[model samples]
Target: MTVMAKPRPTGQPGYSETLPRAAESAAVARRLVRTALAAWGLEDQIDDAVVVITELVSNAVDHGRLTSIRVVVSRPTEDWVRLAVVDRSMAVPLMRTDTNDDRIRGRGLLLVDRLTERWGTDRYRWGKQVWADLRCESAR
Candidate 1:
């Protein structure tokens, strides 16, 4: 796995890391986000960001069936932080509502919907990238 962090500019702090798809990749992704948030002095947004990263990375690993994944965390504007997970799958994720209450899975995107300002996917030549934008009140 390779991790790269960019210097923080006036309004932008960004980093991208690539990791082999594994059960532990989700935790690594969370740690990367936490470290970036700390460097950017955006600790106040850690919890929500971690949750969003976990869901996105988990989906990439569990459903995308990818061999590797790239995670990007960036602050496009002072008040918004975007987390994106890229994988070698072109399939877009769907918000599953057909799952029964008795089942204990398939609710990752539901949590993401409630937590992010907006989320979507982008198709690339190799695969797809799923991303979420979280509003950071303390960033400004």
Candidate 2:
């Protein structure tokens, strides 16, 4: 089961969760995005958000040392929904410069860059937040 945050019609607010990096953080991210969308009555933006969430969680696990992954979701504005993930690593993440070669791994941020309208990072108490903004509407 996934955790659900209560509706707060005010300033910025988010939920945080920690799970082992070995655990299925992607699925939790998916669930968080869906719940956030539904809470805002914007289920139409579901698919796009899920893809972005998956990528974010995957990166957190790959680069982070601690098995714990943290996800934060917020509505920064009426036009965008923000998704963020934190982990227990200090190394910053960068968009993949190399192309997706053979059977190796990578391209998480690359996919995020292409999908999200805007994305950035911020330092947290433990590590950092790699987050992206999803447009509120499909046509946008």
Candidate 3:
């Protein structure tokens, strides 16, 4: 995705990273989210946020043919934390419903939907960004 870097107002802290689009990147992404949340004193949100980010990263790696993927984590306001995953695929993420109960996969977006306050995708010239917003106040 063609994400433009915007300046964070005074004390807002954010973390952004680009990693190779490999299976291992999902774990790295989770760790990054965990560390960022801990640093921001939002550890209570870490578990859910990590799960959301892991799913996003996994989806990007599975669908996007790009060599690398970018992840952005930021607290846009005191009440909300945003996590975004960008990959070089123009296709947006869709929720899958056909998988049987025995299937071990096809439930990433479902989990995200249930956990996040809101989630959506933004299309860019280069690709697309899938993002989820978590309510910080509710998290606590």
Candidate 4:
């Protein structure tokens, strides 16, 4: 899906939203990324966090299509902001190291692993919650 950067007027600092994991989820994620950043007056930092969150939500839509996706944005005491995405998927995303093929679609987890400040998962009876923490310089 092609996503154009959205231009938004600056504003506040926190919001969390949940969206269903479906074919249109990418669009929802993109909108959320832009809205979250703009609402927090941190539109400038949207690229990194958006990119990361995009991948996370994309994975949810792609791998866990029948589940639900959740996103959270917080200033967390000012100095930085955190961007988190959670999905109801029982499959723990595993980073594949055996393949050297760049086109093979398993690179999402690796990319997420390298980009975020911190990332991990939480097990649930029906699924799991995958999350990442994003730090923004102007978040305060």
Deviation from native of the Cα of residue 134 in model 3, angstroms: 0.5
- What tens digits encode model 4's per-residue C-alpha lDDT throughout 40-115? 6667777887677777777777777455778766666445656666666688777767666767776877777777
TM-score of every candidate relative to the true structure: 0.86, 0.82, 0.87, 0.73
- What is the Cα root-mean-square deviation between model 1 and the actual structure? 6.0
Stretches > 4 Å off in candidate 2: 1-13
The CA lDDT at 38 in model 4 is 78
All-Cα superposition RMSD per candidate: 6.0, 5.9, 7.0, 8.8
Better of 1 and 2 by lDDT: 1
Tell me the deviation in Å of residue 109 in model 1: 0.4
Model 3, C-alpha of 28: deviation from truth (Å): 1.2
For model 1, name the residue pairs that clash.
none
> How much is the lDDT of residue 76 in candidate 4?
62
* Model 2 lDDT-worst window of ten: 7-16
lDDT, model 1, position 9 = 66
lDDT of all predictions: 0.87, 0.79, 0.89, 0.70
> Could you tell me how far off, in angstroms, the CA of residue 109 lies in candidate 4 after the best superposition?
1.9
The model with the greatest lDDT is 3
Off by over 4 Å in 4: 1-13, 65-67, 138-140
Evaluate candidate 3 by giving its C-alpha RMSD to the native, one decimal.
7.0
Identify the runs in model 3 with alpha carbons over 4 angstroms from their true place.
1-11, 99-101, 138-140
| lDDT tens readout by residue for model 3, 1-140 | 89998965722668889999998998888988998888778889998999999999999999997799999998887788899999999998998877678888879999999999999999999999999999895545
